[model samples]
Target: MSEPNRFLALFDQVVDQTIAFAELVDRAGYAAVPVDTPALFLGTRVDKIAIGALVRHLLLAEAHWFEQVRDVSPGGVIPFPSNAAALEGIPDGAPLLETYRRSYAERRSQLEALTEADLTKEIVFAGRRYTVIGFLWTVLGHHSFHLGQIDLLMRQQGIEPPEYMEWPEDQRVLG
Candidate 1:
């Protein structure tokens, strides 16, 4: 396959992984994670961002990138919440999930339009300029990184995360 097609395929794979992991997280009930400051796992020094805040950040990032793909400033249809401070004014559970679904659809459409030539497009992210491909890889990396955090937090809270489920033809049941 051509390089662009390869990356596109990889991006689709990551999106599928995101969907699977997100389903598992929802099934494990992310709503159960406490929003309070003193409620982290016993003596754990790494609860810098509350669980609710983390979820908000994830939602915000997904929407932001979706808009960015269109060369548009992020926010018109939805108000952009503060990346870290969204925890203070937590968004509702079902609404946030709906927003996430919409953003995922937007992202898929944007990515579907990607071309090899577009890979050379430059964008600034985290104070550095990167090609579109690099920026997308970074986005996938960021999301996956937090997925790990959410899984760990779930375990610490006595919730077991679901095993990774790769797509296959025979598996007909949804988890």
Candidate 2:
């Protein structure tokens, strides 16, 4: 396979891992836990922001990275409750899942359009330059890093994280 195809395949794998992690969080239930500080996990505090807000933030952040590298603007932030009181208005169930699905689709589409040359080309953002491939890897790494935090929060709440479904033995890339 060509280099771009390989990168795209890896990107898809990362997205799958992210979705799996999100599923764990969703299944763990969204209960209003006591908040001693502003940030709960990874500096994302539960003060004025609803848990849904954090979920949306993560989804939007991923989308933003993809859109930026693709040279397109995915306008507008997804509206979510800003506080515990607002949780009543935020649907804890299907709506959030739908939003995540849509965001994933957008990311996948943006990734599909990338060529090998596109991946290697340097893109400037926030006064810094990164190869498109570097940015994509960063996106994946960022998600993986936060997913661990979310998993930890779930465990702290006495919720077990979902079992990581097994890929084929031959397909296991990590030792």
Give all TM-scores, in the order shown.
Answer: 0.63, 0.66
Query: Which candidate gets the maximum TM-score versus the true structure?
Result: 2
> What would the C-alpha RMSD of candidate 2 be, to one decimal place?
6.1
**lDDT to native, each model:** 0.56, 0.56
The parts of candidate 2 lying over 4 Å away from their true place are: 24-28, 31-35, 39-51, 72-90, 163-175
- lDDT per residue, candidate 2, 60-158, as tens digits? 676666766676322222222233342245465456657667877877887888866667777765555668877677666766665665566566666
Global Cα lDDT for candidate 1: 0.56
What range of 10 consecutive residues in model 1 has the weakest lDDT sum? 72-81
TM-score of 1: 0.63
